[model samples]
Each structure stands twice: as structure tokens, then as C-alpha cells.
Target: MATATGKNAKKTNKQTDTAGTKSSQKDGGSYQAKDIEVLEGLEAVRRRPAMYIGTTDARGLHHLLWEIVDNSVDEFLAGETDRINCTLHKDGSSITVSDNGRGIPVDKHPKTKKSALELILTTLHAGGKFSDKNYARSGGLHGVGSSVVNALSTEMIATVRRDGHEWMQSYKRGQPTAGVKQVRRIRGHGTTIFFRPDDSIFRRTKFNPETIRQHLEDISFIHGGLKIFFHDETKGETHELHHPEGIGAYLEKITTDGQKKSVHEIPFSTEKDDRGNRIEVVLHWTEATDEEVRSYVNGIRTHAGGTHESGLRTGVAKAVKNYMDVHDIKAKGVTVTNDDIREGIVTIISVFLGDPMFQGQTKEKLNNPELSGQVEGLIRPGWKRGSTPTRRLPTRSSAGSCSPPALAWPA
Candidate 1:
């Protein structure tokens, strides 16, 4: 949170080396090529875990869980799976994620000459999601922490069911404990992974089932077609989250959970799916002084408002302007800016696109420049025509859904 100063902020001067290569001199100190230490494979992740997962705290520990679950969610995005299972063991420190989808490839990698499954677990930036050939849209952009998670975990076990056979592999702190072995012949396809976060790396080792369930529930609302089951052995409780109502249902839950009173009865929502790309938005005016906007890209929440959030606000503003223009309304000579239009706004936006640009490996912010415009384009028309001015404040809930030709406010 502090500004950079000192050595970290020092500018380097370029100098020619004995080999005619450029050498960097920081404040006239020796900074040669050999001074650079390269951390290979998952070593870098272990040395600087925060650089990959944001923190070595409880949140980052859960993030490791999200990394695995998100990969399964990617399979769902690819239309390869429908169900994802998350389990917390009695110890509350070990967990597992299972998905019924096309399993990770186990064949030898041409360049690395290692099994694809092993390569993906042991290396960084190695996975089927580098391009859209396997997944047109996925949430595991820079948070593809499979290798990072493996590096930070004290124990990890992977099981894959594909190619009409079952394969298994075990690892401890990113290194394989045994070679990948074919366990048995299997009929279906899917993947299962179990891991325990390293006590030395993470400040917190135990996990909260409530926290995990809330996340799974939120994810269910984002990807409405997918089913997520959370089993908390610690409490002997299981929760199933499958919200086909999508973001619309989520808006209601948000309002109720926060006890926020809404100026509108039924939230205005719109969703459009073109091939694999999809966008869903639900918004309402609230009595709250500040605005609340929950946004996501490919089902991963963007806590830091990004371009897409800006687009949602812009789109809302544009719609309000269009409505006033069509109705010949004015603000009594007062300069009613976009801020006025969104003063008490409550909104949720979810988008799934082929290629997403995130701010960092944490994937907490999306930086896709085109998303601002694309989201605005989609939302502008939907908003202008989605609602009509009511004579009175809206009351009584009407049918709310995110799927559509667009939505209208309750009369």
C-alpha cells in the first residue's frame, strides 16, 4: 500500500559487459547477467507464492481450492461436464474436487517428453487452456494455479478417468512421488484431485465449510446450468447449489442477505448467448446510499471493478438518458449527471468470452479493453427497452429470470 522507494524504485543504467551484452547498473552497483537467479519449474511459485496467488493467508489457501474447481468449471463451459463436487474431510484441512468431464491428457508431451498430466501439475503455464481450441470460454485465466497449488501443497493426489482407463498420480510439494500409473479400466471420463495446503506456506490450514458453500452457491448462480455439491464432513452436512434462475436469483439473494430495500420490485435482467460467448446482467435501484455492483468474467468474481463494471454503469446511464429523451423529461435545470442515475443502483454482471485479459495472476480484475464497449453495446439496448416508467414505486415480486429477449419492470 506504500509507494515504491529505495532499491526497488531505483532506475538501472545500461552498461556494456565483457561479452558485449547489456549489463544493468543500479546506483553504480554491480548488477551483471549472472546476478539473475532463475527459478525453474514450480520453484518460483514456492519461493514467491504471493506473486502467484496474491497472499499466503486463508484466502490464498482457499484460492488453491478455487484453482482446481475452476478448471472443472472450465470443462462445464466447454459443454463437457454438468456436475462438480467439492468435499471437505473431517480434519477440515484436506479437500477434494471432482468433476465428470474429459480428463486431463496422459500422453507424452512432444517438447517436454513428460506425460501431459505430469507436465501440467509440475510446470507453470502448461495446460489445455492456453488457447480456445479446448475451451471457448473459461475462468481459469492467470489463476491457472494447478502447478502453483501443487507447489504450495504438502500433499496432492490426482486421479483421471479417460481413454477407457483410470490413471493415478501422487505428489508432495510439487514433485511426483510416483510415476503416473494406469489404475484400472474405466467406462466414463472425469477427474479428481485431493490436496492439503502446506502448513509452512499458509498461515491458516483449516478451511471453513460455510465459506466454501457460499462460494459454490455463488458460482452456481453465475453458471446456472452447472450443478455444484458441497459435502462438509466436519458438520456432516451437504448442500446442493443449482440455480437455473442465474443472476436474477442472485440479485434477490443479495438484497435479502444485506437487508437492502429496493426501489424496484422485480430486478430488470437480460441475457444473450451467441455460440459460446454469453453475458447476463441484473440490476435494480436500491435505497442504499452507495451503489453495489457484483461482476464476473467466466464465473470468476472480479472483486476489483474492471472494464466490464465500467461498461455496466455506462450502459445504465446511456439507457436512462435514452428514456428521458424519448419521454421529453428534464431535471428542472439541474445538471443530472450519470452519477445521479446510478446513485442507488444495485447490479450484477456475468460474462463469458473466449479470450479474457486479467490484471494479474490472482485474476481479481479483468483488463480486456474491448469488454467495456462490448458489454455496453449489449446492455444499452436491453436497458432502454427493458423497463417503462411506473406511476408508483414498484412492489410485489414478478417472475425474474436472466434468460431472454430482455426484461421489463413489474407493473
Candidate 2:
């Protein structure tokens, strides 16, 4: 009888164990299609802000400025605007960017039935950039910059002066608090955006003035005639950056500040391709062994570099090699490489391409393969132009005299 009781107990324990296993699987392991959550509109941005703007840290904080400034830069590129103003509030809580470009459209959007300004600020992937009619080439081609900034901010206000009137709208965490309303009549045409980044969404909300100044200076240098002004209300200081010489001034500053020696006194070259793509390069060799190359496509800086940089490297190497060969100079053992030619070189390559292809959302690198061939073709002619067997190391004087080949526009 005791043996029989033991067997019954064992069966009950086995049943309890099975029941526990089933309960655990049901609670922890059950995943079905119903479990998938579909975030709509700006919700997706709020859900994964990092995917859009990179991070919620200092880098992302500064990206907000870049996005707003890029819109104004695009205006300058399109021959519409001449000035951009950026202001940081005293308490380090908000920033305001204003541009003299054509203000954002205030008319009702045909598709959304809302003011164009409202649609752009609240909806993801909505803007004038998608169409080439408004912009031939732009840094904010993705149309995500403003909206992403809006979604991540706790409060946003958009004010536009266009069509002889000033219009305004306000938003709270990506949702419109009110429709577009006329603020008053205005004399100028432009748009002003003010926003306070949500402290809850970001790691920190303090704005760095130095970082803002540096980036604004870079933009000013890239766009020759456009002026950028930065005012820090907190510190009661102001800075205005205008570079008429454009990238030439930029190169001068970098080389002078770093005290880098240049192989050429005037270190600048420019060429244009048939497709309206313009290439400008400024380079010099420094005493330091490090190599620095900064490249930009349209107005967007590509820190990672891409095919354009490769083309520049290839062209420089080929040019140097050809010069050596023509002079009967031979390397001792190993072949002279691009690395050898690029040692201690500081180069800035700026290309204006109609439609630039970038590798990722942040546009850290350019990936267009055609740009390589175009740049190579443009640079090779300058090197090969008056070469003879007796020519010595091509000096700055001789190199400058060689005019760039006639631009070949696409048929």
C-alpha cells in the first residue's frame, strides 16, 4: 500500500512540473504577430530618435543646429538668401534660427489639407526637398531634419514672413497646438524657428557656444557670399562670419593656425563638369606627418570620405608618378604609392553635385561612384597639360598656368 502511495505521489509531482513548464512557456515564450507594434508618423521618431539623428547626446544636440542651418544654406545655394542668424537663449534652454530665404509656404497643402508649414513640422518625410522643382541640390534632401528636430523637442514655434504677411504656429512635442495664424504684416521674407529640446529625451540640454560658432563658421566659408551671425544672449556676445574668399579663406585659416607649410604659395584649383557639378580643391603639404582631408558634397560635410576622396588621391598619385617618369626619376625598390604623395597633406575638396548619394542618414560619407571618374577626369588634365620629358618637379607656377580642360557637360 505504501509503494502504491509513492507511485501516486510521483505522478502528481510530474503533473505539477508539466503544468509549471506550460505556464512558463505561455507567459515568457509566446510571441505572435499580434505582439508587433506599428508606430505611426512622428511616433516612430520618438520611439527611436537615435536612428534618425544619431544620438541624444552632445552630437545630436548640435545636429539640431545643423539641420536648421542647412535649410538656410540650401537657400543660399539656390541664390535665394544672403544671411542667416542663430541665437542661443540666456538660460541655455532654447535656440532660434532665422533666415532671409523664402519663408516656408503657408498655404494649405493640397494633400494634407493643412498649412504647408504645419505639415512639414508635424509629419515625417514631408517637405519641399523631395521635389527638384524647389531645390536642384540640397543638404537636407531626406526631408527628415526639421520634423525630427520637432519631434524631439518639448516646444517648437515656426514663424514665416511671406506674401506681405507674417504667419506663426506653435507645437508641443511634435503636435500642433494651433493652426497657422497671421501674426502681423512684415516687410522682409524669411522663416524663423525656435525650439527647446526636451530635457527628458536628451542626456543634457546645455548648449555649447564654441561648437555652434565653429559650425556656423564652416557654413559661412562654404557659401562664399552668405553671412552667418551668432548671438549668445546668455553671455551678451555676438559673432558674425562672412567669408568672401570662401574655401580659400578657410584653407588659409586652417594652414595659418596650424602653422603648416605649403608646397605652393597659392594652393587652390577649380574645375566644372558638364552636369553642372563644380569641384574645388585646396591642398598643401605640412611638416607634420599626419594627413587631413575634408570633403563636402553639395553643402554636407562627409567626414568619412568616399569616392571623391579616392579619386583625388588617385589623380594626385598618377600625376606625381607621371611627372617622375617623364624626368627619368625612378623609385628605389617599392612603387611610389598614394600614401607617399599624400603624406602631411591637408586637402579640402568641395563638390557641388546636383543629386548627391550618401551612405547613411548622417551623411558621413559619399558613395557615388561616378563622382570618382568625374573628379579624376577633371584633375588629370591639369597635371598632364604641358608635360615634357625634360620638365622637373612641377612647381606651383607651372601648375597654375595649366588651364583646366573645357568642361564636358552631359549630352
Candidate 3:
């Protein structure tokens, strides 16, 4: 091995081989454990929180809540958990979520040799979602949620009650203060995540109760009857949202009030196969003015309205047009363009499968191009199956009718 000085090449003395000895072969030098590399700590996140989280403002503050909620959603997807309890402190700077789902696995990760929980919290992009076999459905497709939240929070505490024991861990600015340690022995399984956004990183730590309420409310409606409780510890306020009728009840809640109904609500759904792929589709036709279609893959909202959304739109529009043509009903003067047809139209599209590709860090869209055809093909032909058209009156429905739909799915 040779050593050099940057200032000027300095010759290092080398011992000559003894008379009968042979020279050592050291061209590249020996590779050993000491030569192995390790990345620096989480200090980078403190320097650039925005790079990981989109912003350091109110959106970012809310992101902390989303990250935590994303975890609870994962539990909900797996049959391990159903209820998500969220509480906002009166101070408005903190929020906590408790889920009865199977808590994050506390076992060791084979690759990292660290507790899976710790690996998820400390390392970026580390979790079950990475392994196709382990996670069939995950909201946080790109596993940055926990680590990002840990990185941005001034303080975060995670409590895991599993396997007859209670384990707890805490972190500050991404560095774990203590490793995963048993806090106590418990009889059940679940997880509680409490976090306080760093004022240094966040311009404001205050949370919007309405935003949280709307978010949970939407999830409640989507999942339908998945008991979601919201409590404001600071204000002593508590509210619950759950729907038993599922999407049908969800549609009725949104479409029936004030003014005559112009377009009767119609639901089109069926199961179809695409290149050996199977998908189930649920769609509702409404004459409502705005085009409101929400797509979810395994409870994860595809807000971007990707192929799945496109497929539903294409399939439903084609099906409706075909239905009108078959009946020789000149909707000509009726003029139900896709936009017109969807105007004030509120529809929910959900696709459940073993494999789903969600685009981006937020998992807001279904990216699989095949998804469009899968979803569209499933509902296109089925549109006229058991289809009954209703007339829509040119009047607005009451708020009671518009009061967000209830969502209830059996636990």
C-alpha cells in the first residue's frame, strides 16, 4: 500500500524483503471490515426537510399527520386492524393516532440486522412494502412515511404493544435517542404514534382541525363503517363517522335532496380479466354538475386519477352511450357529454388486487397502464347489466343530501 500527501508527493519508506523472503502482493490493498462504508446519520434531514417532505409550512405540518395515518392505513388493509383513533391536543401543536391493527413488526430485519420497527423509523425507504411477497397492499408504497416523519418531527414517540409486551422508542430530528426497548409486558397488539412537528422546520405547528376532520371523514366514507373516532383533547370534542350501506348508501347520501332529481343514480359494476389480470369495478352514474370520481387501491386514495380513473371514465361513458343507442333514445337534445354526464356527478371507483402500482411518494395515483383497461373492460359491458336510468332535475340538492357520504365496511 502507498500513502501520498496532497500538498506535494511525499515518498513513504518501505521495508525491503529479507534476503530469502518474497515481496507481498498489495496492488489494491486488502479489503476488510474497516474498509466497508456506512452512510452518515439523519443530520441531512434537519438541513433539508423540504427535500423529503414537500414543504415546511402548514402542508408539511399536516404531512406529519398523514405519515402517521398512512401507517394505520397499512394495518387496515391487512386484516390486522380496522379502527383508527385520532386525537388533536388542545394546544394544536400535537396529534396522536392509535390503531388496533397488527403493530409494525418488531422482529429483526434480515438485511439490516436491526429491529424491523427501528429500521422503518431510522432508515429511508426501508419496510415490508419493498418486498413483494410481504406486502400485497400498502398505502405507503415508497416507504418514506415513517422515516420522513421521524426526520421532520422535533420529537416522535412510537409505542408498540405486541407479543405479550409493550415496546417503545423515541426520536428527535431523525436520530433515535434509544434503540427499540421493551417498555412493559402487555396482552394485545396495536400501535400508538404521537408526534410534535419541529417548530424550527415547520413555520407553524398548529394543525387544522377541519382538515383533519375532513380527511378522516373522507376515509370513513371510503372504507365505510370502519369505526374512525376523532377526539379533540384540548376542546373535549369527539366525533365519529361510519356508514353501513357502503358506496350505495354513500351515493344516496350525496344525491337526494332539494330540487327534482334529473338523472337517476345508476351503479355499474362487474369483475373482468385483463391479460390474466382480474379487477372488480364499482361505478355510479349521476347528473351532478361536477365530475367527482375517487379511486382507491386497497384503501389507498389514488387522488391523481390515473389509468384506473381514466378506465372508469372511458368505460362508463362508452357504456352509457351504447345503452342510449341500443334503446334508440335520442339523448341528442338531452346532450349528456362525458363532462355533462359527470357534472355534479359523484362517483367512487375502487379496485382491489394483490398487486397495485401507485405513483409518487404520496401514493396518489394508480400508474399501471394496464389498470385502465382492466377497470374499463370490467365495467364497460356490465354497465347495462341491471342498469336503470333515473332523470335528474335541473336543481341543486340540499346540504343534507350533500352532507358527505357515509362509508362503512365490516371490520
Cα-based TM-score, every candidate: 0.85, 0.87, 0.77
- Candidates sorted by lDDT, descending order? 1, 2, 3
The positional error of residue 194 in candidate 3, measured at the CA in angstroms, is: 0.9
When sorted by TM-score, best at the front, the candidate numbers are 2, 1, 3
Evaluated at residue 330, the lDDT of candidate 1 is 53
Q: lDDT tens digits, residues 1-411, model 3?
A: 975665434223222343213333343346567997655666666677776666788877787788788778777766678788999998899888999877888888887788988888888778777655765666676677888888888888989988999899998878889989998888888999888888888888899988888777767766664878999876798988776556655555555532224244345445555564445555444544556676777666676888888988887667656665666645323445565444555667766656677665666677788887777776666744553544332223232122111111111
Give the Cα lDDT of each candidate: 0.82, 0.80, 0.69
lDDT of 2 at 21: 89
Top candidate, metric lDDT: 1
Cα lDDT tens digits, model 1, 105-198, are 9999999899999999988888877777888788776534798989999999999999999999999999999999999998999999999999
List the pairs of residues colliding in candidate 2.
274-409
| Superposition error at 325 for model 1 (Å) | 4.0
Q: lDDT (0-100) at residue 65 of candidate 3?
A: 88
Best model number under TM-score = 2
In the order shown, the candidates' Cα RMSDs to the true structure are 10.0, 6.0, 10.8
Candidate 2 Cα errors over 4 Å, as ranges: 1-29, 333-335, 385-411
